[model samples]
Target: MVAFGFTVANAVAAWFAHYDPVNIGWRLMFAFAAVPALVQLVGFLFLPETPRYLINHGREKEAQEVLHRLYDNDKEWIAYEMGEVAREMRREAILRQESGDEFVLRRVLRTAHVRKALALGCALQMFQQLAGINTILYYTSSIIRSAGVHDKITTIWISCGISTVQAVGTILPLNLIERLGRRTLVLSSLIGVVITLCMMGGAFILINYDSSKINPAQAYIGIDMNSTNTNKELLDLCFGFRNCDECVTSEYCGYCSLKEESSSLPTTFGQCLPVNSENIQHSLYGYCKDSMNNATAYSFTDTSCKTRFTALPIVIMILYISVYSLGMGPIPWVFNAEVYPIWARGTCVALSTFTNWTFNLLMSLTYLSLSQAITKHGAFFLYAGISFIGFIIFYFFVPETRGRRIEEIERLFMSEKEITPERNQRHEKTVSASVI
Candidate 1:
């Protein structure tokens, strides 16, 4: 639901950006997020405390009242539920007394079962960020622009669309978590993420390489090929020959206005070379210096140079977002909560949550710089490689928590000597009666 709310907010922002009535529309969109917090605050005022929490705090009378109200005055069920909660609380208190005043973190680290759980919890959170979903979310607009989408409104809408797809994809795992199991969904999601990232990287590579090759002659003229002192004179001649009004420099090749005006001078400087030119046949554009001192312009013929592969990156991104939302989005939270014993559950999950946000911040902060340093395609390819390594680690070390009791899960990490038969039998009975 949090993810859904964020996606909807972004969609609203995109809609406003498209029609920005007074130029403050984007600000309004950001402000829309605060509405949910206000709503939650109001709703929380009327919310009742859970029966177990009341019981745990020694408010048995209030707990009973709350449970009676919750179960529609079913006295038998409330009694049974209260007994279970009381027994669990007593067991936890006994365990705490036996363990003495040791720090929760120290205990967690010292215990074999909990240490394993902590490792898995931390690792899952780390992999979630390292997989680069946040990178895609934070930089979707920039990525759309890099994919050759030139329209500002179109890029904003496409980003909103991707978020919408992710929100919808999250529903699949909610339904499949019990049926398909965590291991299946997680493994499948990783595979899908790897494939889509590779495809996205390949698409960018193709487009960038093709665009780079379109006009090699104009690109080379001022830099390497025409190394005479007349380089400045040649650059001036190229600039003079350009008809700014008729030439669109933003396109793949700057069309020569002079060629259209008269067929006599068939060739012009910094323009796209002919399709049959030796350099053009070799897919190499000559380099020329533009008015901007450091900028290089490649020569190209006036043919339509845009590739049909322009839409491929967006398509691959949508696939990647959808796959990530399916399992990676929600399973880590569930696993983190379920892996630890009641005494350490809150502390362990908090530590894991902190790890999650820390890595999330790191990823968001470094993504743009990393992309600029290694290229966007390379960054995604790097994420794919990390995801592959993560998949292997998870398969070997992470247990399937579905259909298992918390005690059973903890015991999975313990040896036979560590788990006595009497305790196991007691846990089985507790598991049969207790609510997760």
Candidate 2:
């Protein structure tokens, strides 16, 4: 349900556009998110806890009751499920008996396989955030604006379309995560992510590269700064820029395309005039500045340039979201739940969940700053690099847990590739003896 709530921002924007003209639509959008939160809070009251939780909490009868209800009281299926859960619980009890500690955290850290599972779970969460999912979702409007869309209503509708695609695309994972397996889906998604990120980055690079070819002298020939209270700093920051992209991306600048050169936006190195705060539709200074009479022939844009490359990013955004939804978007949470041993599952999953949000907060806080500092394309490139590294790590580290039981997953973590402490000690001694 949360996956589909992205369109609510557009809904709130629409309401603000129609019923209210106060410009508080953005604040209301945030307030509206609480609506779903409240709904889920109310809805969960009637929802049953998962059978595993009941089984783990020493309520086997409740676990069986849930399985019966879930399975339509199918006796054979319920028995099979009860056996699996009970057997896993019994095995975990035996292991804990031998480990000499009753504490979940200590046991998780001490057991070699649980430790590996915990590490892998945490790493997956970190990589999920590093993929910049939050940046794409949170800054969809800014991204659309940067794609050369200036009309608020048009931008809002386009954003709603993208959000709808994302919300619907989330359904793909539920069907695919089973057949494709956890690692396969994520690796596949990462491949798509790397490719799409590079493509998106290339698109931004093209926008800047094409705009940079325009000669500023030709584009701003008749344009002149205001005669009074002229800002030299603004001149250097916005006017001194050579490209429409550089100007439009700056928070305080608007690109003013010379009327004669408007036909060839690719080469029309437009003037970067200071933005009019009162009315962002026009510039604060120069021939492009707002006027009731004697309107300038120049076209102005604060968010983006009037360029042909506008539609490319929109297409790429849809493609990226589609690819992501089928894999990395939802699989990390599933895999984290599947990997840990029963004895350590709760503690380990909580730790990984904490890591997921911590990194999410970190990325959300830094994405815009990173984009501003590195340029949008450069930021995408950096994320692509991080994703490439993630690809390699996940390939070598994450095990397929689709059909595997918790016990089976625990053993996979302890498979031949895992070097036990005793094995490491022996290997070290052999190396030392060889040196002698």
Candidate 3:
């Protein structure tokens, strides 16, 4: 709520800040962010550890206290609930004993369903990172600049606003998620994302192809991969691309002159064919200057712009945030949590988390390289295509598991050859009776 509120407020502010306050935009952004961090600190002070955590460590008395605090004057009800929970725990322990399934990696890897779940979990994590969310998040200012917002203040404000919207977007589904099935939500979100991305790409293409109403110096330019100057490459790495051609000067006007022309005894008494135009060197005795200076003309432009990102880009940006939050924002974490059988839940969660980090590393490491090699639009387009592919894969192969029990969901992935009606019946009986 805070983040979304901030976004909406900032958007209003941007549309009506009176003066173009692009000068101190970044500092203003940090100031706003600090307010939330301070608020979060205050919130933490009032929050207590959950009863589940207390009970997980067998601190029944503390759990009881928590339940009492939560329910108030319902000590007997709390005690009854705790007893039932304890009985369920004991039943689960007995099941684990009977089934001989240890909550360990070795045991999890031996199960075919668990293995399939792991694959899906890993794949989801990989998809989320490869979508370039973190790269955009971390370098939002640069991304905005590349999109043509040149003024530091404008870029910072836009970045903070976008981030605030993304954070705000998280709450939308949080409120509506239970009402909608997971698969439907994910698919719907992806479709929105596909549209937003295509729009964003169109915006870039429009900016690129349009050649009216702007100074040449203010327009975006292509990076010349065949640039000869090493200095240009280094600068491009730091601040997108700069045309070295822009640095050339008129001083290098077509020629270099040799030193001491005709000064050696006046070129042997001014012989040597008097004055050959192409083969002549002229030198004077006192303070002589070369006829031409070494200079060239270079034309270049920075990719950033303050005036270009008007209302249209802002709308497209918000759409991007909405779509992102709807699907890519939450699914990875949810899938990571749900894709494992209970016995291997911990291991699966860890593996899925590792998969997320691994893909994050890949995206982080490759993002700049890809951007430098293939321009911003191409990079984002590539990500959109990959996301589309992932959407399709999820639509077909991924099971719908909105409100299903984790164990029941696991059976859906079990080896068909090993799972018969008798086996399923026994499995259901074991699960219901709290057999492992």
Any runs in candidate 2 off by more than 4 Å, and if so which? Answer: 8-12, 19-24, 27-31, 41-103, 212-228, 258-269, 276-279, 290-298, 415-436
Question: Could you tell me the TM-score of candidate 3?
Answer: 0.67
- All candidates: TM-score: 0.75, 0.79, 0.67
Candidate of highest TM-score: 2
lDDT of 3 by residue, 50-92 (tens): 7656776889888888788888959789977777667666665
lDDT of 2 by residue, 276-356 (tens): 888887877666777723235677787876667999989999999899888888988898878875557779889999999
Better of 1 and 2 by TM-score: 2
Give lDDT tens digits, candidate 1, residues 1-436. 7668657866787777766635677678768778988999999998889888997778889998888778999989998888888777776766677579999899999888888889889988999999999988988877777666656677778888888898888887878999988888888888888888888879867765644232334534434445553344443333332232112222222332222334443234434321223332212223322333322223323322344566888899888988888888888998998889888998899999999999999999988678656766788899999999999999898888899977777887777776988877766655554443
C-alpha RMSD in Å of predicted model 2 compared with the true structure: 7.4
Scanning candidate 2 in windows of ten residues, the lowest lDDT window is 427-436
Model 1 error, position 88 (Å): 2.5
Q: Which of 1 and 3 is ahead in TM-score? A: 1
**lDDT of the candidates, in the order given:** 0.70, 0.78, 0.60
Judge candidate 2 at residue 276 and give its lDDT: 84
lDDT of 3 at 237: 33
Which stretches in model 3 have alpha-carbon errors above 4 Å? Answer: 1-59, 98-103, 211-313
Query: What's model 3's lDDT at 366?
Result: 78
